[model samples]
Target chain A: MSTAKQPDPARRNERSRQAILDAARELVTEVGYAKVTIEAIAARAGVGKQTIYRWWRSRGAVIFDSFLALSEGAEGLALPDTGDIEADLKTVMRATVAEFADPGFEAPIRALNSEIINDPELAAQYREKLAGPVDEAKKARLRSAQRAGQLAADADLDLALELLYAPLYQRWLHRSGPLTPEYADALVELTLRAFRP
Target chain B: MSTAKQPDPARRNERSRQAILDAARELVTEVGYAKVTIEAIAARAGVGKQTIYRWWRSRGAVIFDSFLALSEGAEGLALPDTGDIEADLKTVMRATVAEFADPGFEAPIRALNSEIINDPELAAQYREKLAGPVDEAKKARLRSAQRAGQLAADADLDLALELLYAPLYQRWLHRSGPLTPEYADALVELTLRAFRP
Candidate 1:
């Protein structure tokens, strides 16, 4: 039958999506966020401009999707629940430090950050699509800690998460200080003290 | 005297510098960091491009100086030393919250952040010129607290400052949460707990 010669539309669509995201991440890192265009992304992905437009409204949307895919590819970012909040936090934080320090992630992440900083719409999308899920996971871990009496029963988890993570983020953003394993350990220890039961 | 018809060289230089900085800030707020041109700044300030070049190598440098001038104009950002660390911290942090929330600061500051995030040289300049002095003042306040036995005797002051401020910065940058006085007070309380003697 003629159907035997036809490609599966769903499979083709999935591959095209993956290809577009990959092209976006590569181009953003290579050329910086401001210079990367929809046409360029389409060319790099071996797709039509219309295809890219059909999927994403702008270059920022494509870049955001790339970051979302990158996170999902990195094991869904499930925080380790070892029942020891301090240990789990240190482990996860150290991994984060390592990722931020990696050359592969450095440029693309900075590009993502600059785009997010400049564009309020993209920033809002980032919060909803990317940060929301990751933060929810971290809060789930904190709730587990609270249940185990490691943290204050009524501690504001949002503030607790901010205190735990924002210093590392600031240091990286400003290049204010080094991101080391010891730094990761110290943040966890201090945050625990702050939220002690 | 012939000199009577001419402006003082030092005063002329100072006025030109102020004009350039003012123009840079206004243009960056109006057009954003990426689109602001040396030509536009020169035109707006009624100076030549060579003049901007004579002082700064690029637009980012000009913008950094603008922020530097802004901070200097804001009373050199001296942290209050009221001897009660918590009360003083609350006052300063609330002021910071207000500043970040100000519509006037919102655009230019966001422009500054994105520029700093993308340019390493500009970021280094920002550290040495802008953040350095303000941090020293905060550290001085923290040292006073340490002397009063309020914080740990050997507390890492740099880290302590980061703990107190970075969360607020992250919240503002990410639009992840509100910048409220109560939030500022909570940061002070938690940071103090973290470094309790």
Candidate 2:
């Protein structure tokens, strides 16, 4: 064994993992979730198919993990708390609108959504692993608002988050309307009006 | 030629149309949207491939029209206008929750949604054909509420509709929450509270 030429196993493993995720994301965008296969992902990532199989159980797992990796950076995300719930919400919501509007996120998110809709198991995994954490962060902000008397103490934060985010999401999914900062602000205004203390 | 028993061409065409739609709906539910195809739909409908192509453009079109045919009976539906928007909206929204939960509608609708999320052209057609008329009826009810001094006089009806329905829709799509009649009623309450004059 040439010890001087040995590659760091940990770093190499991390590189392969990232390559697989990026390949999954790119293939989903280019050809869609259904057409994205493990073989294709392995080829695109320059890894052996066994390398992918060693990590992910199925195509859906790889795709879900691709999305999870994208949001991994935002794992610690917390909505800004400015005491003024309205302002904080608008800022966060507008940021959401901008993110959805970005070309980088558009196709992959649409692919992810389609996958989630069709596969209930993946949907469950997504809620627990992906949405669960982000929702908790947003809820913490809402709870803070409740403490500040800015929102009703009895407000169902889950429902409130849905109200605040779903309209934009539906619009984006269906292309039913524009996703503008103004639209984001309007949703925030209406949700606040709906849930006022 | 059995002229005495000749079937009318128009009636034959109508039968073929219904059979095709039923077949499309059935196949989508059975195999999911990705696996459903014109050939399967044709075989199940007992019609020729040319017949499906004659009336529809693609698999997405057929799936969308299957949904359209289901709602064709309710094309002229008007929301109950007892001058009480809250009760009327609750009634409509609860009916929606029930519809989404129905086994008869479940798989086909999920397939349709997956298709819509991935295909922009199909999404536009859905908005125009399926959602437009339904939204118009709901808007009329909101307008009546406005005239009754219930909702804000100049409320944006489109935005109001989204707030009222999108929350329930997101929950159903993500399977993130239940689609109870109580859930529907809560949306109506929060929407009404949000837009109350």
Candidate 3:
């Protein structure tokens, strides 16, 4: 017979946490960040408000965590290095474009983004949790490209990364234009030319 | 005095409208967009709520108009053509950086931007009133540059415009970094290089 621990309290706690986060994300998509309440998240998750308060400080914090949860496993946000800088950046950006096109993902992310912009503390947490990792990954990829001599030795990786991603982000946030794979490809080509030795 | 025509009700109405818009901008900066109300704007401007309702349809519309009023005299958003695309873009971008750094401009603009992103109708209106003009101006400048042989003859002006301003907009909305003049200058140079013939 296989021996098993008695229900695994830690696993149960993690499941509860996941449930709460799932509920928060759903409520945020349905009702928006401003209308999302901890009480509502708790009720939706079949947990008590104390359970939520035990983990998060405010509704904003919960929403931020929920956003991170949603972004997890999103392949587009990941920086891939497949020995070709152009192809790698295009792959990642196309994934990002696809993510932005999904209403299920876009609504909650945009709502949380608004909250982050409004609240400095939450913004800091978001940058640390979400943006910081993506930025570091992209920078690492760019540094690798430099090492491979694909980019100018003196290229500003930070600025180059912004050029790669900022146009898509601007269009996404402002609804200036469609976020298409074609647009992503154009940005990749332009960025490569700009950074080429 | 010789041509005074019963105090010119049109001019009086224009003054009241300006007062209301000014009051809306000030209140948005002070109390934030969420807390700003028609009543508050009226009281601050010494006008009645009916006067505001007579012109604007909602608080969002009022805030939108208030933002336009605030931007009326700003030199940054204007696309200047000095026969040199690099110099002109750099000048405008540096001015934009300065404008964003001003708290009075930042708070109200940020507030209005959040509202625009949240409401599609408002976002459309914002695009028409604000983004439309700036985009047209930039495109005009880029087309002129194309004629002058500064840009590729077949360069995608729309995409090129995004490359010019999107980085600044991304940094502004995300608070990803300091909105410095140096950052603006770097973007200008990168874009010029990317679009070169």
Candidate 4:
């Protein structure tokens, strides 16, 4: 049970990590963030508690990893980089609409994000595991478009980045509105009109 | 303790409700949401628990009502409705930045919003009491601006609403970036540009 990220040794270790993540994800979905524990995850994964502690700090950290893995496997989830910035953004946003609609990824992520609001340590893990990569991907796309003169040269990339992605996250978290495919296209159009000058 | 809005004959009940709201807001700031109870609110306001609960559903509901009252009193806090859409939006958003910076409002609000994520009933109360009004205020401003020819006639008001407000909410909830006055100006400018044909 160490806080350090050690190098993986063999295929067996990879299998064990996968099994542990799977079990933890399932248990958290079945129970919840407050109720899921190392003992339950161990029993489900057929591993010792120390096995989980070997690579993660707490249940929050393990669940964060599980969400990251799930996001990785989701199809059409990447920010597209085709030369047409409008088309690429629409493609990515549409993909996100589908991803958020998926049961496997949405429920656990929402539950974890809900917890992060009150827990500082878990909130940090959430920003690192969830917002960090997505933020980077979006900034890269905006920068590339600006560089190619598709977007206004003076367009603030960070503002554009936040503008494009924030609505999706808001809808997903608040359950305030439908992130339908039509909504995705409309968002893209609005963003492009704003960014294109 | 039941959940129903009551009519006050002498307005004694109205005064009591305001007193309870004031006490709840003050105590929630000091003690946080989880510890702010019906009994404490009653004691602080010199009333009984049934007196407090005669009008609202739960502690979260009372806290939410208090938050709403605070926002509503600051008359300048509503979205500005000058014929110049950009300037009006910037005025409203700048005011929002000031509100976000106010510790008296921000601390208790942060605590209460965090707790609501885990409580669906509270979340519903929150949406109605807080989110719904702010959203309605924005829509009304947009409508007036559109009518004044400050915006395109056919702009999709619903999606436009998301574009203007969701980014600020997302940043506030996630602690992803600074919700500065500059960012607010940027949002208004970006949204205005998007509406251009």
RMSD of each: 2.3, 2.4, 3.3, 6.0
Model 3 over residues A1-197: C-alpha lDDT tens digits? 34374577788899999999999999988987678888899999999999999998888888789888876754355467889999998898898899889988887878887887788788787777778777887888898999999998899887887888888877888787998999889999999888888
* Interface RMSD per candidate (angstroms): 0.7, 0.7, 1.1, 1.9
Alpha carbon deviation, residue B169, candidate 3 (Å): 1.4
Ranking by DockQ: 2, 1, 3, 4
What does candidate 2's lDDT look like per residue over B101-187, in tens digits? 987788878887877887788888888888988898888888889989999998889999999889888988999998999999999
Of the candidates numbered 3 and 4, which has the greater TM-score value? 3
Runs in model 4 deviating more than 4 A are A1-20, A32-62, A72-78, B1-23, B34-62, B72-78, B115-121
| Model 3, span B75-150: residue lDDT tens | 3554677899999988988988998889878889899888887888888878887778777778888999999999
| Error of model 1, residue A129, in angstroms | 1.5
Which stretch of 10 consecutive residues in model 3 chain A shows the poorest summed lDDT? A70-79
Off by over 4 Å in 2: A1-10, A31-35, B1-8
- Over the stretch B6-30, how does candidate 4's per-residue lDDT look in tens digits? 6545588778888999999899889
Q: Please give the lDDT score at residue B22 for candidate 4.
A: 93
Tell me the tens digit of each residue's lDDT in model 1 across A115-162: 787778888988877788788888988999999999999999999989
- The TM-score that candidate 3 achieves is 0.89
Candidate No. with top DockQ: 2
Off by over 4 Å in 3: A1-16, A73-78, B1-13, B73-78
